[model samples]
Target: MDERTVRKTISQLAYCYAVNRRVSDPVQFSIAGLTGKAEKIFNSYPSYSNWDVNVSNKNLDELWNPKQIVYLTADSNNLLETLNEDKVYIIGGLLDHNHHKVFEILVNFCQSLDWKKAFLNVIPKRKGIGEEILSEYKKGEEITTVLIMLSLSGASNQPPGTAFIWISSILAIIVDCLLIMTIGLELEKSLFSYQSLLNWPLVECIFSSLFAINFFISIWLCFNGKSFSDDRTSYSLAATFSLANFVQYTLNVIYHVRTWIAEQKSAMQVIDPRGVGVTSYGGP
Candidate 1:
C-alpha cells in the first residue's frame, strides 16, 4: 500500500482490529504494494509494528501460486459463492475510484499492454460499505463482505477471543441464575407475610425494575442477532442470551408457584378451627 493511503487508513485498520479482536475470527492484513521508497516510510509507523503485518514488494502472482490467488473486485461479474481453501484473497491495497480500471481495460482489451492471463478471473462482491470501488470508508465501518467471504471460504474460525466471550457468557448466566434464586426466595418470604403487598422502597423497586428490563433486553438482542449479521460471534452471543433468559424465566415460574403455595398456607392458618370465625394475622 502507498504510504499516504496507509496513513489515512491506519486508524480504520486499528478500529477493525479492535472490533475483531473481541470476536471469534479476525482477518489478517498484509501490505503487498509497497515499493522501496514507500517501504522505508512505512517502517517509521509504530502501529504497523504492533501486529503481524507482512510487507512484500512482489505482486500476487509472484507471491502466491496462481491457483491459490483470488482477486476480489467490485467490477467483475463473477460472484463469490464460497471461499476457497488455502487461497490468498487479493484486494486492492490502494483505495481508488477504479483508477486501475483503465489499465485493466487496456490489458484485457488491447494488445498494446504487456498483460498476462494471471490478472483474469476476478470475483465480484455484491455488497460492501457503500461503493463498488471504495478507496475510503467511514469511521468504525465494518467490512461485512470480507467477513462473509472469510466465513464462506472456511478461513473463519473461533479464535481465542471467541472462547473468552464464551467464558464471559457462561459467567453472566451463573450470575443471572443467582439473582433469579434471590428473587425467588424473596417472593416466597413475601407470600407468607403481607409485606410483599406493601409499598416497596423506591430504591429497591427501581433496582429490581432495572434488572428485569436488562434481562428482557438481553433476550431481545440475542434473538435478533441474525438481523445484525450472520457472523459466528453474533450467533454465539444470541445463544448465550437465549440460554440465560430460559434459565431466568423458568426460575421465575417456579418462584410464582412457591409463592402461591405459601399464600394458600397463610390463608389456611388464619381460618378458625371451628369454621365459625376468622382470625386476623399480624401484618409483615
Candidate 2:
C-alpha cells in the first residue's frame, strides 16, 4: 500500500467505525495480518493509534475461537440469515477487486481444520462493494482492505458493525428497528407477556419496508432520471423488484400489536378473578 492509499483506507475505516457508533449498538473494530507497508501508514496517522491492530503471525484458526466466528465473505451465495452478539465476524483485508481471494482461502483453511464454521452475508447479492468499507473512496484511489470484527453487540435487531450496508437492506433495517421499538413500547404499557409477541410478523414488515423504499426511490428516479454510474443495472433491478415486493407483503405490524393487546385484556380479567380492578403497567 502506498502512502496515499493507506491514508484513504484509514479514512474509510474511520467512516465505517463512525457509522457503527451511530446505530443503537456499536461494533468493535480491529485489524489483523498487518503487512509492514500498512504499519507505516498507521504510524503516520497518530489519531488512529488506539485502534486494535494485531500484528501476530498466528493463522486465523489458532487466533480465533471457531464457535464464535462469522466470516463476512464477498460471495453472495453465502448470505447470512441472522447475526448474534456472541460471534466474531471476520472480513477480508484487501480493498480492491481481488479481495475475495483472501476470504476464499480463509474459508477453505477453516474447513480443513474440521472446525465448525458459520458464514454470513452482510454485503448485497448484487455486484458492488461487497465489503463497504471502501465505498466513500473513489475507484483507483489508494486502497487497502482491513479486517474488522464485531465480537460484541450494542447493535439493534441486526448486527451494528458492517463493512458494507446494502442500499436496499439499509432501508429495511431502519424500518425494522422502528417497528421493534413501537411494538416494545406497546408491550411495556400493557399486561401482555413476552410470549404473546412471539410470531409478530416481523419478517413481513422488513420486506414491506425494503420494497416500499426501493419502489419509491425507483419511481422518483424514473421521473427525475439518474446520472450514469458504474452500477446502474443493479440499482435499477433493485428498484423494480422492490416495487413488485411492496404490495406482496402488506400485513400491518400495528395490527398484530393491537390483536396482542386485545388478547391480553381478555386474559387480564381471568388473572384478576376477584374484580379488584388491578391492571399492569410497565415497571422498572
Candidate 3:
C-alpha cells in the first residue's frame, strides 16, 4: 500500500481500538505483514501503538500458527458470525473493481498456504476514513496561523484591500474543507438520496465552480497589485494554491458526471487511467 493508504488503515485500526475499549469487553489486535511504507508509518505514529495492539514486520503466517490461521476472503461462502477471542483471523483488503484478478490470485495463494478461509461479518466503510487525519491537519494549520498572526503586527503595512482578500481566501478554505468532508461522508449513500439539503453531487458542483472562479479572482487580485511585498506574497501563494485546487477539482467534477451517467445507463464502468481521458474508457 502507498503511504496514504497505510495511514488510513492504521487510523481505522485505531478507531476500532477506541470503539472496542469503550465496550464492556475489549479485544486485542495484532497487525502483521508490515513492510515498506506501512512499517515506517506504524513505527512513527504513536497512535498506532494502542494499548491492546501489537505491530510486527513479520508476515501473518510467521507471526501466528498457520494451522490456526483463518484467511478471510470476500468470496468465501462461510460467514464468521461469531467472535472468538482466541481464533486467529486474517482479513483481506479492498476488492478491486476488476474482480477476477484479486479473487483468483487470493484463492491460489490461500490454497498454496493451506490456510482456512471464511468471510468476516463486518466490512470496512469509507464514510469516516481519513476523517481523523483531516481534523488533525486542519487543527495544525489553524494553530500555526494563530501563532503567526499574534507575533506579526503588519496590519498597517498591508495593502488597502489585503484584509478582504485574506478573509475571502480563509472563507473559501473553510467552505472547501467542509465540502470535502461532506463528500466523503455521503460516498456510500444511495444513488437517488437527494432529499437532504446538501447531497454529494450538489456539493461537488458548487465546490468545482467556486474553485475555478476563486483561481481567476486570486490571479486578478495579484496582478492588480496594490499590495505591499508581504501582501503580494500572500496573493501569489493564494493564486498558486487556487490553481492547483481547480485542476484537481476539475477531475472531481469529471468523475461526478461520469458516475451520474453510469447510474442513468445502469452500467458500471471503470474509470480511464489518468492521462488517457476524463471519464471511463470502454477500451484498454
Candidate 4:
C-alpha cells in the first residue's frame, strides 16, 4: 500500500482507539504482529544477546495484531529506517500504552535527521494522523482550564502583591541597619530600642513581608499569564491562574496568621480592664 493509504489506515485505527478508549481487534492484531517482527529484528542483533528474547517474544505474541499487519509494520519500519538508519532498528510497538512507544520511535527517527528534512518526511503523514491528535489535546486543555478557574473564585489577589511588599521591606530593613550604625556613631546609644531588635515597627514589617511575597507571586503570575496567553482556551488559562492565585492566597493566609499572633501578644501586654490595684496579673 502507498504511504498515504497506510497512514489513513493507522488514523482510522487510532480513531477507533480514541473513541473506544481501547484498541480494537484489527489494530490490536496488527500491532501484535509488528511487535513480533520488531522483536525478531531486535533479538537478531548481536549487541542484545545478553538480554532475554523469549520473554519479549512471548509478550509480543500475546498482544493483538491488527488486520493490516504487513502494511502497518513493514511501512512504518521502512519509513523510520529510511529517515534514520542508525535508530530505526530500535523502533518497537505501535499500540502499546496509548501508542507512546510508537510516537517516541517517530521522534527519535526525526531527531536523527535535520529539522527541515525530517519535517518534509513526516509532514504528509502527520497531516493525516498527528494533526488530529494535536487538535484533540488542545481542545481538552481548554476545557480543563475553564473548570480550574471556576473552582478558584474565592482566592484573594492581595497575597501576591503583599508578598512583593514583604521582600522590599526586608531590603529596607537592611538599609535601616546601616542608618542605625551611623546614628550610633554620633551618639553613645543605639539608634533603635532593644525591643526593636526582636520586633521592628509592625507596619514596616507587615508591608515589607507583603511586598516580598507579592514580588515572587507577581513573577509567578506573569509566567502563568504568558503560558495561558499562548493558548486562549478557558481550561488552560483557568488552571494556570487558579494555581497562581492559590499560591498567592496561601501566602496571604500565612501573613494573616502571623499578624493575628502579634495582635494576641500585644493584647496580652495591655493593662487589666477590671481596674483593680492588680498591676500585671501574670507572674514575671
lDDT of 2 by residue, 1-284 (tens): 66677766656566555544444534455566655776677667776766543444355667778888777864665645344567777775545443233333333334332111211233333555543434333231222111112111111122222324344456666776788667634534333344654444444555556555554444434323323343355345544555456444445545566678888777665435345554453222
Residue pairs in collision within model 1: 83-153, 95-135
lDDT of 1 by residue, 1-284 (tens): 55676665444444434543543444454567666656566577676677665667877777778998778777887745334448776756554433233223322323322122212312134444224333332211234333221222112222223344345556665665665556533533344345655222222333444444444444344334345544475645545545554555565566567768977886766755356554566333
lDDT of 4 by residue, 1-284 (tens): 44444444445434433433321211111233323344454445464454222233343325423331223354443332233222212224343334333433344334443333333344555447656655665564555344323432222122233344456646765664554455423433222323333232333344444444444444444335324433344334445555554665566576577667767766776666577535455533
Best by lDDT, which number? Answer: 3
Cα distance off (Å), candidate 2, residue 97:
7.9
Which regions in candidate 3 have their CA more than 4 angstroms from the true location? 93-284
Ranking by TM-score: 3, 2, 1, 4
lDDT of 1 at 197: 51
**Could you tell me the lDDT of residue 249 within candidate 1?**
55
**TM-score, every prediction:** 0.31, 0.32, 0.32, 0.23
* Pairs in steric clash, model 3: none
C-alpha positional error of residue 264 in candidate 4 after TM-score superposition, expressed in Å: 34
TM-score for candidate 2, please give it. Answer: 0.32
